[model samples]
Target: MTALRPAPALLEAAFEAAREAMVLCTADRVVVMANEAARHLLPSARPGSPAPAPLPADGADSFQAEHEGRQLYGMRRELDDGHHAWFLRDHTEELARTTALEVERSRTAFLAEAGRRLSASLHMRRCVRTAVELAATHLADAAIVVLPPERRQSAWTRLLPGLPVEEGTLREPQLGEVPGLLEALGGFPPIPSRWLDPSQAPGWLVPAGFGPVGALLVIPLPGNAEPAGALILARCGPAAVFTSEDEVLARIFAARAGAAVSAAVLYREQVDTTAILQADLLPPELPEPEGFELTGAYQAAREGLRIGGDFYDVFGPAGASTDTVIALGDVCGTGPEAAVLTGKVRQTLRALRLVHTEPAAMLTVLNEALLQQSSRQPRFVTMVIGSVHRIDHGRVQLELASGGHPAPLVLRHDGSVEEVPTSGTLIGVLPRTVVRPATVELAPGELCLLYSDGLTEARGGPTGTEQFGEGRLHQALSECRGMPGAVAVERIRQLVSDWVRGGDSDDIAMLAVRAPTRTPLSLRGGGAPAQSPYVIAARRGDRRPRNF
Candidate 1:
């Protein structure tokens, strides 16, 4: 015989063998039939009893409930004769997976937020405070951060839930008060959180009135090449405790905080170094109370640097009749490389002047001294060295020599500008370099300007490519005829700055020496002689002070 179909009544038996729990209920809400699965899924399900409290209300068909300890999910379908069949299955594993997924997402978001807030600042105080605040809000009731020691003392900051942050430095001896803290600061292997008794925390580590301590952890802050600091986290109450996952997170956060703090420290050190170098390279006090009134200006080619290759110094005896040497030099290159040579050349000239005070003779000795440094790179120098002396009340004589430097310009009181004819071989270049001494004189109320080529070689104009040139400088000097040395130097600098129009420039250095003009005493009412220039400066209506 062919395979015969099961009778309609056998379908009822098929329902009994189903894996999911099935129940048949009457219109009166009484259970008519309960399968084996239903009895195992919900212990309360039985024949002739009210269908499990819910029975899938008026228009809805699906429901879920906790029967005993198992989760049951069910749905209802209408059947013939005012009867209904309810089907349910256990879905505890699926529900558990969904909850786990949500938890992972939340943790990922927390880490992302931590990174964003920590990277926002390069300041140590802000970074450490941020780290502790974040840790307190998420990981613990209170947090503390300790920085590596600079000498004998280390800095630390603490934060409690309701109190203001407290920070101070602690000595090395104080570190022994806490267990595992010194090791953490040393970047030793992680110490298990369980080993430290939270209840026994040091008074200094935890703020006063912090009740009970239930958990404690210490982690090292990582840096570029070494440990930058350490982080401490604590919680209150016996129920609060740290897990392995929490320790990993703390280490990661500490690393980020440490890097930011170390970077800030590095930046501060670099700024301090630059400031010291700037102070050292700046021109010192010029030869004052001497025959000539001197004023100088200097600018570095590099944007942030204060000194390049150009330098100037004046050294000698202090008297109107005595000779004083004025040396302004330019090294072969630019920036630090050239600036290095500038210092060496200046120091050599300073020491040699003790033996040879004569202008040309001192330069020759300086050349020889520089060449003797066989270890140094052979860098050439262009300089104007002059021995100045006040010959009379109205004139100052300058015995000058050039070492392949720009010719000095004299701005006469008649509004005339002329360059002194002085030229020679470059200094510090050859074993035997030629130097010739030349003499010039500055009349009262007149200036003799010595400048580096940076003043004339600046490239900027209508097209931003043309040099300022000597012709323009000559015309500019003419307008400074009667102006004092300081005023003339400032005026020339302003002109050059304007010509460049914010373009990059080489090191510009200018030294202007002017002979004081003698003014006759013109008293107002035959009462008192003329007041000094300094006194005139204090009075309003009086002209600007000068080298009178």
Candidate 2:
């Protein structure tokens, strides 16, 4: 046999010199050899029984091996011979770094999710609670507090786990009360009090038996121009010092929190203001038409930090012997300005009734007034005006004039919706123009629906690909043919709300009036004429004055 020139011993010595633990085992479960690293790692290695089963079959060459209290790793390879070799490598430091990375990733994910939740939440209390919990669990051992402008004491406070206990502590300073601190820091930037030793600062005070405070982090809750409140954190243990990295993360979180709070506050205020203005602008109750029962509802868009301009008004007289008129309009903007304009339009329409009796003529006059008033601004208004005249017997005559508004929808008793043929230019665009009002004869039980653009312009579907157009409105009205006007209006509101998924981009105003056939006068005959008694009385009384 050719001499095997001591290759096995040399190879064994080379393997022993390597830093990685090395072991060679035969297929029959007998240990062929083991290097110094392998010997050091496994003190019990004689001729191993199974060679620790070649690290898991996956391609990962290195993995942990927890033997006793210490952690290690075993890398494996198949030798040129049929034997298998395992190289042991300690991985304690690498594992520590990987664990830290994973923790940081989890923290980032948690913060992102918290921000989304805060943005979506409508209730301020719940949002504040959730935010505090998120920061306490993920960011640091913090005490979150929110203070309202009216509340002399702090708004709320949530103590994080492991914080020093303070009982009945009702007084805390809000950022509004600390203008000096905020101005000193320039725009209320976050400041770390940990740098100043707790014992050195005169303001640092510890509770009964608690140890000296380790760190303090103060962040201001910002609003339109100034800080609204302050977020104060107190730490106790040696590891509680607020680091620069911690301050950076806190500032980011504070920014999101401040924005969410500001948005919510603004939304609530706008809603209140809009509701008040809309209620004030619209008449409390519509005048009863001679042959009609009127029911109406108005809704503002659920968007932005402003109120919209959608309004409905009913003028003229009440009862069977009276002429009832209805008007619905939308201003082209949002917020207090639009609300102001809406109020003006309603007032103008009401005032026009004193001079004009014709619906089209009254709209024309109001249009001129609006144009004169809004000449300096680059906006216009759309309106639909209607007058109901009780004709002889149970029949009623409806006259409608549209100014760049959606055509009124008429629902017949037979479940058919007809888009009324009424179209004209928007008001406030022309200084003087003739408005031709369309006339329609309504039988008993027929209903008319007048609405603004909000219902027709709602974005549809998951991607907002479609709009709840005029066709959809017609379909919805047709579906509720036999329902009462009040019920129908409610259903329409519900349908619109659902189609928009609680998100509306524009303001919606709707008014529905149903012409009832039977008159109270039919039960009793001495009733006056359907024409205004005041006008007739005035005409009779004016004969002597005209003669003079």
Candidate 3:
């Protein structure tokens, strides 16, 4: 018997049982044959009905087609009977996997770039702004950085395409004003992360204007002893709920920003403290004794955190109406400790003035006091002290004493400069201080200048290594013989500041006392004073002619 051909019904039944979908259609695209898998994939295709769309006509060619809500990949073949045939496979699962991988890769790249931008600045405000922009752009619809109440401000930012980044500050709120914020501020992880509708958000969160938030994350920024602040990220509309990966990124960014802000805050505090301390150490106001005009200038060393040890003061005539004391001194070092010693020296002198009227005697007692403390503190001072006693006709007698200091210069009315002759070992050393006293009469239109070594020892020139030297200081003073006391002090300060190119050298202190010009009536009856021409020329802002 001849092999029997498999019946058409049996062949169709085999097709129905196969897993792959199979469809047979005429060239005109009418479906004539379809297996159970094919009918399940495309319910719209029936025998004697047109195919859903044109079938692929080449061998093993793949094309996408929709069947109900499912996506199918079709492999087409041309049958021997001139009908069009296709093998269909469901591809929706594979497509979803690929798309997810692409999204994850993009997010990873975004995080790395965000981190770089955030760390680019150590400035507190700039770091906060960078963090806000990054989060709003990549991680959330809206972002907020809320500083602790002590910090006093908050920042908000959001992602709105085609618009500029929005940012502003809100005054920090009291703890009781917002629910759950305190817990977050305590460094606790937001449990299940906060999810709230926009209308229900706390007042602090309202500035961000995140519409209908679907998920919110509150992460604390850590500090050494406490939480520095909180970072709030909110997603709105249909954005995906924050995942574990997102939480990790938020914590990292906040930590970096928090560190930078804490450093800035601490730096500002240190600067303010330094300013107050320096102000206290320096003289507040100069003493203006009768028959005298006085001015003083103090410059701290410009180099470091330390204010220098140079100091000056003018006070008194306390017990003796005719005597006023002026002192300029320098301690051995720079910094807060040296500054403290400067204050001690000034106070000791002030106290000594009440008991001692003579400059030499007063300095000897101060030396004893410093020597007593030397074993414990071991510092010395270089000083020049003067007592001005008024005499006949607008003239004063200066009893000057020096303790290992640059001698004071007396710029006389006749344009002659003289160094007061006084000398001794620096104070706070040697058991007994030997201070030599010299007396000079400061006539009308004369000035007495007392200064620390910073003026004479300043290093500068064409080579920038030479000391400004006493000769230069003398020349500078000789030019201002008849100027007011205040003008003389300021001129010297400006010269030294310019000489040093505003660099940090040693601390500088200067004090000047000027006597007023005498009237011709007081010049022993109609005799012209030697100071007359210079005083008149100085008042006109001009130099005196040599023989006038």
Candidate 4:
């Protein structure tokens, strides 16, 4: 306050020597002073010229502005005389660094999203296509190729954008040359690439600016622990060097892709194997029976992993006879265990037939044997065994026994359907229970139908709980009355299939027997005296008096 001393010119000159641009302006936008940098930026600075338009206000200390296409940051302060002093700094390098960081962040976000989408897709073909598209879009590759394992003379090959590949043109990879690349990536196998030997590479190189083939990734697909296929990726483009990040990403994606392809191939193989086993278990065709015509069909349940135990057998004459036997049975459970039980039951039943003419006795013996031989597993079987005998002309007798099975439906010539109810508990439930036989007399042109529970228990109708019960079955049988046994059985099967509409939860086994209108004896006798029913005496254990 004593004597105002003018600022030294040296102070101004020293400030001009600094790197940042500096300037001084009055509140009314008048140029007062400027540093060398500011003078260099303008090139129009005069000793006392007016300041540029849009001068900064007092206390606006930090802000950005553009000058001659260059960005500048500045701070302003108020002077004692209501004037303003502004200081400017160039921020070009800082802005450039910030922009580069943002770009990298966006790239990382895109790669993360792409990887998630690739892993989530369940369809193998769609996942492969998406991966290829990702490589082409992000990695800037010239082409992407995937080769599956060799099968027969050819391996499966798919190129991105569907590049046309000539038949038998793709060759297998040589693994020995690329040991270093495979060793660097743990658990990754080498896929033979055509470019390994420069001479074998395609003539079409990438454009001049684009780079060489940077890397090849190979992944092995193991199906049920057995090598089933492989996935290969070829990357080439400008700046196409494979970074450490790329190797990590490719390794993860390849593992996921290999697993998906393996699952699909294994599923296909299992389906084929099951179908073959089912075919082997089923009979080629039922034998033609004589007075009574017989037709039988067997089908395995589709949902079960193995063939079911539903089976039908017609033994003896097709005609009505005291000895003709028709048997339909369903063993408990499904698959291999049930199939083995079915074989045992069939063998036992056949053996019992030699000693017992009555169906009930034969079933009792079979049940006892099954209970004794089978493990104490909670299992049982349903069966319907029937014997047809001709008593006199125009009369055929049917003796039936049911073991917890659906009663056989009898279709008469008069278009009426009747269910023949037989009494017996399920076999293998009670070791010594006796089965009760029911008898029916068949008239000329009448049919008898035997079926497993699969036909009646099929889901259908409203409530989604309604079953194709006995009523529907009877109606179907009545509709097919007087038809040939083979034709009638086939119609019944079709009607059941339609009612179920293919919703068969269990296996179906059916057998149909129809007494022919003409007697077998009449056919053999040539309209003369009929011979007696052929008799084959069964043997019994000798019971001579034992020595005391």
Measured on C-alpha atoms, candidate 4 has an lDDT of 0.63
**Compared to the true structure, candidate 3 yields what TM-score?**
0.71
Q: Using alpha carbons, what is the TM-score of model 2?
A: 0.51
Worst 10 residues of 3 by lDDT: 531-540
lDDT of 1 by residue, 60-166 (tens): 68888766666678888889768988887888778888887887787678778888888887776887788888888877899988888879999998889898888
Residues 218-300, candidate 4, lDDT per residue (tens digit)? 44543345544444455654334555555555555555555655665555567678677656456436655445567787667
Residue 55 shift from truth in candidate 2, angstroms = 26
Off by over 4 Å in 3: 1-138, 150-174, 194-199, 207-210, 238-240, 303-306, 316-323, 335-337, 351-358, 372-377, 501-504, 520-548
Flag the better candidate by TM-score, 1 or 2.
1
Q: Write the per-residue lDDT of candidate 2 for residues 167-285, one digit (tens) a residue.
A: 22234443423323334223456656644454442232334344555676667766556554555555767666877777777777767776677676677788787777657664457
The lDDT of each candidate is 0.79, 0.67, 0.74, 0.63
Worst 10 residues of 1 by lDDT: 532-541
Residue ranges of candidate 2 with Cα displaced over 4 Å: 1-123, 151-153, 159-216, 222-224, 236-252, 259-292, 297-311, 316-324, 328-344, 354-360, 370-432, 435-548
Best by TM-score: 1
lDDT value, residue 434 of candidate 1: 82
Q: Write the per-residue lDDT of candidate 3 for residues 131-161, one digit (tens) a residue.
A: 6777677777777666666566555443343
Which of candidates 3 and 4 is the stronger one according to TM-score? 3
